[model samples]
Target: MTDVRSELVADPVGEPREVAPTTRDVTGLDELVVRCTACPRLVAWREEVARVKRAAFRAETYWGRPVPGFGPPDAALAVVGLAPAAHGANRTGRMFTGDRSGDVLYRAMYDVGLASQPAVTGPGDGMRLHGARITAPVRCAPPANKPTPAERDTCRPWMARELALLRPTLRVVLALGGFGWQAVLPVLDEEVWQVPRPRPKFGHRAHAVLPATDGGPDLHLLGSYHVSQQNTFTGKLTPAMLREVLHQAKDLAGLS
Candidate 1:
């Protein structure tokens, strides 16, 4: 695993209060995100969870820091999630890994040909995604899986930069929940696409299209219920339902 500190760059001047503008390429930005401690609450909670490892993972080392987006830079689709899970990404160092939520998501993606594996045990587990990238609105795991509005706003610049870097090839965005749906709108506005005057509401299969700037291309946005236990366990979101959404997104993105 890479050392987050060793990959850090000196703090740049005139950057936003919390989220810094990306001065390097996507790879550099990934490293930069893992080193961020913009929100004191998130930093404290993530570290606390790592230090007090769950009984099952007591013998395992935790990533503890911010989890960066994963997948190819040229991906045509992006799956945006909420914050990391305390015992999940906060422990595994990869978003949507080492948890039930990730289990459901990866399985669906793999079935739809977006992922090479149906499960990811850790960062180096050799699981990969094709034509799609996985990321979150907030990089760090928040307390009780919830981040305050101020924390979300403070962390906006990173998501903004990540989306900007992916803009060239990105054609579709799959927001896993309302939180992610809301998070992406403003970020997209700052990038190549602009949200409508009255934002589209989030719902299962909710769809919206924003024409690219200067007649570049049209971007599609879709929504789905988060793959949390609350949704999956209660049948609010099922495997078939999720797979349907993913298949549609893959087709829309024109992935083979």
Candidate 2:
């Protein structure tokens, strides 16, 4: 099978500290993640979300702006989630921003020493991350927070481009849920991933050892149930479980 959506890897560039603010690294999906207007329906939904949430939580105004992938400028670990949460990253622009999901993620990141701050309100909230980054399969907010398969496919290339930037040092990836892993696995080396498991079943804490390709870095990809309210409130994903995953990630990256 085709690997990691190879179509866009042709002209992949070096990991630059400064990407164009208005445009993403490439003119492909990465670029589109920042400027895409294909899903008008979701855009409208995001706007409404921002408006109401902004009014209610005036102090914590929703980001409601273009959600940008985040991490230390040169992080090695990239955590991929399904999509932006409506009141979270979709509004705040930063992955996992503005809501409970982010609260859990940032807390976990902090507990395991990955986050610069314990909570994320928006991009300007003065928080930062180290040795790790976070992104999603889709950049835009989807209706009812679900991206259609075509939408996810359209957004995959940008993620690939982002992954390309970490090139030599991207030692590990933590896929938040099944979809996030499925979207990313193909573009990477097969040996990097453990054999695929049945779909719809999330493998929390599982890990795959990936050898470098084309002289790229070796990688360790781990799995985690998304720390969404669904998982957290239901007690499927706990703070300790999430922290343990981060601890594994740090160990894998030799970050300690």
Candidate 3:
């Protein structure tokens, strides 16, 4: 993967901008993410979606850019998702905000005492997370909510950097969906956590214990079905099920 700074930053209209790479701080990474235009298809699609606004949000401005991870920087737990929804995080500039998926996810976290509020309507809704953080494998809102393999690979370095920043304090990772499960393994491996041979398959409540290494803390990986409408509406994943997984994570992370 290339350095995040080498990746081109897209202008609002999908044009590349002239900018230097930044330092590896939470603030710098946040700025770098919104500026990323590394994937041409993602850049064009995200900009188009923003331009042709959703009817419900026509009067509002769209973020139409990469959505940065949100939560405590030194959190003990990290909840990862596939990517931003076209009308969710892309519209609100916060991961999982302004969507049914987020509504379900945050509510479950709140039930497990990880979140302060059950509803996450937007970035300014006063929603707060304690002891846990939420992020995604991909930052941009891909067309039809699916990012290509190339795009996923291209976007991996950002997630890698994110996990590296969180490695010191991060004790457990809750991966939502198979995409997030697959996405997190490589990042964990790069951080020197000993992943088992013949990798663990993703399933509801799938578990893997990555032992501590090189002074880094031991890491716990847990899997759950995504909070997408397709899954929730069809009853593939329910609130109680999601809350149970979060409760397990909270206990393992030693969060009250």
> Which stretches of model 1 miss by more than 4 angstroms?
1-19
> Model 2 over residues 135-210: C-alpha lDDT tens digits?
8777767878788887776556567667766665678888998888787786553333333444323499878776
Full-model lDDT, candidate 1: 0.86
Candidate 1 C-alpha lDDT tens digits along 57-132: 9999888888889899888999999999999998998889999999999999999999999888987889999999
Tens digit per residue, CA lDDT, model 3, 86-179: 9889889999998999999999988889899989888888999999989888999898889998888778777777777787788899999999
Error of 1 at 64 (Å): 0.5
Error of 1 at 253 (Å): 0.7
**TM-score sort, best first:** 1, 3, 2
Alpha-carbon TM-score of each model against the true structure: 0.92, 0.79, 0.91
Q: What is the Å distance of residue 106 in model 2 from its true position?
A: 0.5
Best by TM-score: 1
lDDT of each: 0.86, 0.70, 0.83
Off by over 4 Å in 3: 1-22
**Candidate topping lDDT:** 1
